[model samples]
Target: MTKALNEFLESNLKELKDNGLYNEINVVEGANGAEITIDGRKMINLSSNNYLGLATNETLKQAAKSAVDSHGVGAGAVRTINGTLDLHVELEETLAKFKGTEAAIAYQSGFNCNMAAISAVMNKHDAILSDELNHASIIDGCRLSKAKIIRVKHSDMDDLRQKAKEAVESGQYNKVMYITDGVFSMDGDVAKLPEIVEIAEEFGLITYVDDAHGSGVMGKGAGTVKHFGLQDKIDFQIGTLSKAIGVVGGYVAGSQQLIDWLKVASRPFLFSTSLAPGDTKAITEAVQMLMDSTELHDKLWENGDYLKEGLKSLGFDIGHSETPITPCIIGDEKTTQQFSKRLMEEGVYAKSIVFPTVPKGTGRVRNMPTAAHTKEMLDEALKVYEKVGKELGVLS
Candidate 1:
């Protein structure tokens, strides 16, 4: 390695360590579920995004194993070069039906889906009006599109309308697109998509909603757009199979024309190898299960409510979460991290968010309660929370 490059990297890493911004990754042994084992200790897990508890579902695992036995483990090449197996086609078709869209296209990952879809339709001649609180992937995808990006206030419909009106009236670009997360992950707040759709219609702007978190948690697992009954009104419906479906992949559901264009133009789908057959089959089975019933979805919400109410009764500031995600807010960064550390030591595993991930001085420990978590598990976690909170002076 070059000496200059080594020095630059060392300096940056030193700064991160000095500032307490360095992340220490914990190794989880065994499958991720309602509980997990880390470093030879079992802990009540609250850091996962497995909303419906399907990640280790017996049905999904069986489907994956069956597919692996028949089709092997990998897709040999990119979709355009014959890697597009019948499994892929079936997965996309299932996704479209589940999403109530005309058609859909799948990608290797959620991040890849955002990068591929945004750049496929947007270019330098276009402008994208993005929510200030949109996910990092959406931000990166917009940047990669080479489009002029304008930030609208978070979930502020009036601001979006004004900016959209100006962009349209000014005629500074060929097209203007508005994009936002269907559910803001950090705060667990659902987007004001109805008002947004109304504004998009009046302004003739393209609409995009990244429903990664909302897909398995909202609208009986149909998602935020369907929750608002505006599926046909939105131009792009992006979702992930990893979070709630308990598998791995992402997709964009839209008009047939849009799916067709993405298939031909999206670089990741065109050049990168397709999703493995096992993953594809597993995702298909998961989506089918989601469509078949709302049992898992309801259980997830029940657990969320149980946790939220438990924390609230204990006088902890849980923030304004409208979903299963729970945030125990602690102002200072170091204190918040310390609280999280203490929780882990006491047999709970919740991660702290500070600074760049969330605003400085507004740090928090986020909890994700899933359908798989038993009442006994949540009660035990709560008892630990109470003990830790009192010791830290977070609760009286």
Candidate 2:
């Protein structure tokens, strides 16, 4: 490496370490479920996005095994280049039906799904109004689009309305779009989609919702759009098969025209390899399970509520989370990391969120309570939380 590049890397690494901003990832020993084994210690897991606990579900496992047996493991090419498998087509169709859209297209992952969809529709000639607290993928995707980006305050509908009015009346761009997450992952807040839809309609703007954390958790397991009955109002409904579906992939559900355009215009779909055959089939089975019953969804909400109540009762400042996502705010970055470490020592595996992932000084230990957790597990986790919170002086 060049000397200049070496120096830059060393300085940045030092800065991150000094500021307690560097992340240390823990490797899971086996299947990631309600309980995870990390560093040879079994602990109650509170940090996974497997909301429905379908990642290790026997049904999904068998589906993947069966697909691998028949389809031979890989898709062999990109979607437009004969990579499309029968399993891929079936997954997209199930996604569309579940989201109440006419058609859907899958991508390799959620990050690239945003990259593919945003850039495919918008360009330098257009503008996009995005929520300030939107995920990193959304920010990167907007940058890739080369469109004029207008940062809207987080869920401030009034601010959104004012910005929409200005961007529309200015007539500075040919087309505009408003984008948000169905559920804010960090704070666990739900987006004001109804108001957003009104603003988009008034301004003739496109609507895109990336429900990566909301699918299979909201709208009776359909998502935020269906929770409010706005399936037809939103133009692009994007989701991740990795989260609730507990597999790997992302998708965009919309009208047939939009789907057709993406199949042709989306760069990732045309360039990147398609999702693996086994994963596609497994994702289809998971989505089908979600549609067939709400047992897992209901249980997830119940556990979420139970955990939240326990955390709050213990005097931890769990943030205003509308979903199963719970954030225990710790004001300092190092302290937050320390708290998470202490939790691990006490038999819990909730991770810390520091600068960049969340605003500096608002560091937190975000907990994701899934349906796979039993009441006994939650109780034990809460006991650990009490011990750690008191030891850290985060509670009275």
lDDT of 2 by residue, 1-396 (tens): 999999999999999999999999899999999999998999999999999999999999999999999998889998887999888889899999999999999999999899999999999999999999998999999999999999999999999999988998998999989999999999999999988998888889899999999999999999999999999999999999899989998999999999999999999999988999889999999999999999999999999999999999988898889999999998899999999999999999999999999999999999999999999999999999998888889987
Query: What lDDT is reached at residue 139 by model 1?
Result: 95
Residue 124 of model 1 has an lDDT of 98
Candidate 1 local Cα displacement, residue 367, angstroms: 0.4
Q: Give the TM-score of candidate 2.
A: 0.99
| Model 2: worst 10 consecutive residues (lDDT sum) | 387-396
TM-score of every prediction relative to native: 0.98, 0.99
The local lDDT score (0 to 100) that residue 99 gets in candidate 1 is 93
TM-score of model number 1: 0.98
How many clashes show up per model?
0, 0
The model with the greatest TM-score is 2
Each model's Cα RMSD: 1.0, 0.7
Lowest lDDT block of 10, candidate 1: 15-24
Q: Which stretches of candidate 2 lie over 4 Å from their true place?
A: none
